[model samples]
Target: MTDKTKPEVEPYDGGEPTELVTIDIEEGTGEAATAGATVDVHYLGVDFESGEEFDSSWSRGQSVNFPLKQLIAGWQEGIPGMKVGGRRQLIVPPALAYGPAGSGHRLSGRTLIFVIDLMGVS
Candidate 1:
């Protein structure tokens, strides 16, 4: 959310990311993923463009797994196609993150950034 007059950054300001700048994933596209879809991802989430680091699985030395529908819109759309042991990134936009509601906390109304690594897909 910059002045709009400034160059279009990935995440933008007000969207003050930790790193402060910019930055997707694999396989199944349209269809929904199943519960057994055992997904292994190393992610780095932030406010976008600012390339900050709100969350990173790698930093914690781990990955996450869950049903497709349970994830965010961006994740539901982004975390597909990844075969078991595959890895990728997810450059999520604001609309896809918290939508209009926003997270209310530190998330507020900011665009989110995520580096999703598709480690494994069941």
Candidate 2:
């Protein structure tokens, strides 16, 4: 995907999700991602409750490369099966995100929404 525009993540008003939710905005025909793959993606993250942006790779003018295994549970579960060039949204509950309250991470205890554009998988 060559588009550099950052995706807008709307606040979720449907209440906190009890499990990881994955929604594909655009489908891709490239190689599919797997649980053990390393992926390159551009993404935006927002607090589900506050509707405030917490992070964005678009802001940095670069995509990020990450090992799926090192990411949060939500991403590990949500990203697999997605193909390169796809744009997807993931709604992550605290347990699958930073974990429950007092997990030491600032986003702990809170649900998060993320818009991810898959660039490549290897």
Candidate 3:
């Protein structure tokens, strides 16, 4: 018999059905981050489970400015404390990600990997 626990390739869920794996940040946003707070950043969203890319700003060479708190729970918890011009990666679990049903545009039940670039905060 073969050992199924040896680990094998499976469909990527974007961390949608798994536990969150948090990466330590040299700096992170404080708990004071509020909604509508403006920030500049570039990010990439990938499916950690399936090893597929979902989104990325590096390819576009653009950083975006938006409220960190206004983003999803995972993003809210992922971003912050990153100094301007800093970059970081976040592994979001499914619970903290899109949830069970997933979302539109090929984002369903997937764990998300984000490489975020901090540009400015406003």
Score every model by TM-score. Answer: 0.61, 0.95, 0.67
**For candidate 3, what's the RMSD?**
10.3
Candidate 2 lDDT by residue in tens digits, 1-122:
48648998865657789899899989978999999999999999999988899999999999999999999999999999999989999999999999899989999999999999999999
lDDT, residue 69, candidate 1: 73
Question: What is candidate 3's lDDT per residue for 12-87, written digit by digit as tens?
Answer: 4343435555554334433323345677766667777667776665566566677776676777766655565445
TM-score of 3: 0.67
Best by TM-score: 2
- How far out, in Å, is residue 16 in model 1? 13
lDDT of 1 by residue, 1-122 (tens): 11112112243335333221222223323333344465655566765545556776666766676667777776776665444433345555556666554456566556676665555455
Clashes found in each candidate (C-alpha, N, C closer than 3 A):
21, 0, 16
Looking at candidate 3, what is the lDDT of residue 2?
13
